[model samples]
Target chain A: MMDILSRLNNYTTIVVALGAAVLGMISGVIGSYSVIRKQSLIGDGVSHSALPGVVLAFMMTGNKSTEVLLLGALVAGILAAGFIIGIVKNSRIKFDSALALVMSVFFGTGLVLLSIVQKTPDSAQAGLSRFIFGQVSAILKRDVYIMTIVSAVLILLVILFWKEFKLFSFDPEYAHTLGFKPMRLNLLLMLMTVFTIIIGLQTVGVILMSAMLIAPGVAARQWTDRLWLMIVLSAVFGAGAGVIGAFSSSLAEKLPTGPAIVVVISIIVLISILIAPNRGLISKALRRRKSKKGWLEKGVKGGDII
Target chain B: MNPQLEIQLIAIFIATACALPGVFLVLRKMTMMSDSISHTTLLGIVLAFFIVHDLSSPFLVVGAAAMGVITVWLTESLHKTKLVSEDSSIGIVFPLLFSIAVILISKYAGSVHLDSDSVLEGDLVSAPFYRLELFGVSIGAKYIYISLFYLILNIVLIAVFFKELKVSAFDPMLASVLGFSPILLHYGLMSLVSITAVGAFEAVGSILVIAFMAGPPVTAYLLTDDLKKMLFISGGMGALNAVLGFQLARFFDVSISGAMAVMTGVTFLIVFIFAPQRGLISIALRRKRQKLSFGMLNLLIHLLSHENSEYETREAEHCSLANHLHWHEGYARKIVDKLIIEKLIVVENGILKLTDTGRTYTSNEYSKIFNN
Candidate 1:
């Protein structure tokens, strides 16, 4: 363990691990609101929509800076969110249909742009495809610093507006009555969500970023009922998964880091759903068995109630 | 057959196959579940390949079908806990399974022929090269046959159990009372989706499969209210999209599946805006028409109620309508002109009065508005 720690003390592993951990925590913190609002799939929609932004940014700038690409992704993701809201409000289409439409169209357009870039006689476009399935080892130390700053700002904002967000997530109408502008708050949350998704695009890719948003919140929900506690727990779980996944992927040869992190978080969620005290499957099953045994001992037949 | 024609045929067949089950998914508000199932089936294909050591093994189909059911089951189970929502469960489950498959593929890229690119965006241009041979005879593309088989199976299933499916989709309680298990039918339909999804996975990637599955059904949904018509229209729309999307790809010299998915969205967009009854334009038009008629009726009722009042009589001129109703003068004039054209009102010596026809209409409108 000491030798492994010393080996991982190198600059690259530490930076990658820290970057993944920050991404995981930010995703968890922002994802809690979306999950509680029952808009979890919007993360999926936003992440997929960011693909075109990345490509367009590269095309326009003729450079592969992470900041430029992420800014482009932010613009595209916000537009996609607006498009979804417009469709849902202006037409008879439901939320899911709007989500599916924006996701597929944006991703498809991204593919078209990517193919165009690939067909061009420029070798610089080689690494652009790696955004689909992210290569964490390729992340430089500067990218880690950007991730750290973004995540710190996100966490600080979440802490600052905790009450308003809680009300917005739990009861928007009541929040409106209390003089809070739910729509503006919603837009803010969505903007933050888009930012979180864009920053993680270099690490988790578009396809699997939704998992990072969902799994941590899901796993933490099993352990608590309070909103604040759930958020804290979710961040911890997400960070733990990130560290473990990064470590294991580094130890194993040819194991991609993003999926490894996602798989780790998923295992955490699976265990939480199965073994958590009151909400878990096993505990519920055990309680049912106890009730059945109690009924039998009291001379009550199974069909008596029916 | 020409390779282009063969590709179009495969595209159409795949679209039609997906659309059959897709109608049910759209109606039941489970279109996102199909997305989850398609992604999770990647793990199924990987596991099946590892076990059977062949990409063409029938067990891959079985394994993928089973995985689809498992995907639905896990999502439903998580949903049943009341801890996570239905969409969250889906968001959680499929990515986990899909990521595992992706990790496995990357870890063992040497031994396995599967790549993430093919899994996400399939090579329809090369689909024709993988031909199926049967008994020393050359068949068409293997995916074409596979899609055809599933399409027929889906048609037969829907035909035989139309009533059950209809009942379960619209009202599962009624289905249960009528001795039809909605759960059983749900799993059965999910299995068919799984099978169809796997068949199309190699021809069109998982993303396009989702577009093909949901797009045509939703487009048809905007055009019709009848389920039977919805199914038929969606199938036709799917076929049409396939051909048009192929032409579009050729025109642009871009990725075929990406072009196909875009065309699917384009088709839906056209229907969304232009469908006769349920479209955005129509709905807006209907609302505008209702507002105009409602304004005219209100004017007639106001005249009828205040015919003998001295103050109303003093303000009963054609120009007074703008003040009486607080509307713009042009809008008031337009409404007055339309009412006069309908012979519901008349202006005599600058005092407006409801005609005999207008009096009866106002009373009827009054009763309709208040009595209901």
Candidate 2:
């Protein structure tokens, strides 16, 4: 523990952990909305599709600035979302099919562009491929600041539209009847999912980023029925996982930070599923057993009286 | 066989192999399952590697295929809990397994020949070098044989269980009542998906394996309604995508697998837009034509109803048609001109008249519409 704490005193470790924590917190909050709304896999689609944007940003600017690259990722992610929506809306294809098709195709395009970037003889391209698996240890102090600000704005938007989002998520038809446009709210929520995914692309990378988006919400859901509490608990879980994952990966050698974060969040989800109050597997089983015992005792007494 | 030819053959076989199970996946609305299974299979390969200490062992495929089924089973279990949605369940399970695989690879197997990058981004260009040798005789690439084995396995299984798969996919309850085990069929199909993913991932990568599995089947789905025709069309689409993707990569000197995925997407888009019956363009054109004909029908019906009525001058005039029909002037004029071109309606002294053909069409359509 002391060794881990001492390592956190390192400047690079602190920056990476901070960035990851902020990313985890916002993704958790937004991810709860997505999970409840049954749009969990959109995160997966958006993250994979963001790769092309990252590569394109690098190619156009010839630099690896986090802001510019992420901007590119945001554009590509939205465009991919558009493709998914368009496909599902216009054709007989279902949502999952469109997502899988769009996600793979976009990632493939990114890979092609990445190959092109590699042959350009630019030394900056060396760091570009890291976006695939992500190396959070390479995140600069500046990147963390940007991530924090963007995440703050996202959280603010969530707060401002909390009641509307809750309504739309739980009962979209009812929300529509109540004068809220479900389509507009859904689009807003999807944009949040896309932005949260874009911000986390550098921290958890594209492939495993979906876990970060999904696991916390799932874990928090096991502990609470209220939407606000679920959101808060999810954010806490996400931040905890991010910090621990970043710290542990930093402490060890050869452990990639993105996978480390995913592993940590997944563990949280597992434990939450097994033991959280009310809805957990063990708790539910225990309650069932108690009810059965109570019923048996009452039945025996009634038989004696008869 | 030549190296380039071997590569193309491997791609074609892999594409077809993926498409076989892919048809069911698309039909079952479980296309994302392939995406999840493809990622989780890495853990199987890694665990199998640790046991055999060999990268080329057949156990890897078995282990990967098992892991794929486990992924489906786990996701279903989580969904059964009712705490999380099905998509969330899949989103959670696969990444956990894949993360463990990645962590294991980086921590213990870092020194080994295994790496996640090569698994996610397969090198089809070097596939020809993994040649198969049998009893001092050399054959084509080893991948060609592996993929061919999988292709044949898929074809045979799908052929033998066509009825069961079709029934279960369309309606699980009906299939179960008919004495076919839904559990067995579901797992059997999942197992096929896993094995196909493993077989194809060597050349196309795990991610693009989804493209090979989903893209062609979906495109074929837009073109046909029959199950057998869909399967055949999907297979043909897979083969066509492989050839086109190869040529594209050759022209651009890019990654063949990536190029293949792009081609798969491009082909799907083209088919999505231009399919004869179901394409977006055809659907829109059909809608437009229907709108025009409906307008002409309305015009004819109106003129016939008021031919000698007192309101004929009031309602059937060319200028008054817009008010009666609630159409914008431009749209009214456009359809009116279309009717004139088709000899459906004639304008005489500011009054509208229906030709004999137009009158017959209107009466027939009116009866057809009312009967329906």
Best by TM-score: 2
Q: Give the range of the ten consecutive residues with the poorest summed lDDT in model 1 chain B.
A: B109-118
TM-score of each: 0.92, 0.93
Task: Report the number of clashing residue pairs per model.
Answer: 0, 0
Please list the residue runs of candidate 2 whose C-alpha ends up more than 4 Å from where it truly belongs after superposition.
Answer: A1-4, A171-183, A251-255, A290-306, B299-313, B338-372
The sequence of per-residue lDDT tens digits that candidate 2 reaches over residues A92-158 is 8999999999999998888888878888865788867577557677778877887788888998999
The per-model DockQ list reads: 0.59, 0.72
Q: Model 2, B222-287: lDDT tens per residue?
A: 999999999999999999999999989889988888889899999999999999998999999999
Residue-by-residue lDDT tens digits, candidate 1, A1-306: 887877678787788788888888888999888888888888888877887788899999988877787887889899999988877777666788678767877777777788778888979888775665576666777877888899999888898899999999999999999999987998889888888888888777866688888889999989888999999989998888988888888888888888888889999998998998898889989999999899886666556765
lDDT of each: 0.85, 0.89
- Candidate 1: misplaced stretches above 4 Å? A156-161, A176-183, A275-278, A282-306, B56-58, B109-111, B134-139, B313-324, B328-330, B346-351
Weakest lDDT window of 10 consecutive positions for candidate 2 chain A = A127-136
lDDT digits (tens) for residues B84-169 of candidate 1: 78889999988888888888888765576777666777778987887889997768788678778888998999999999999999
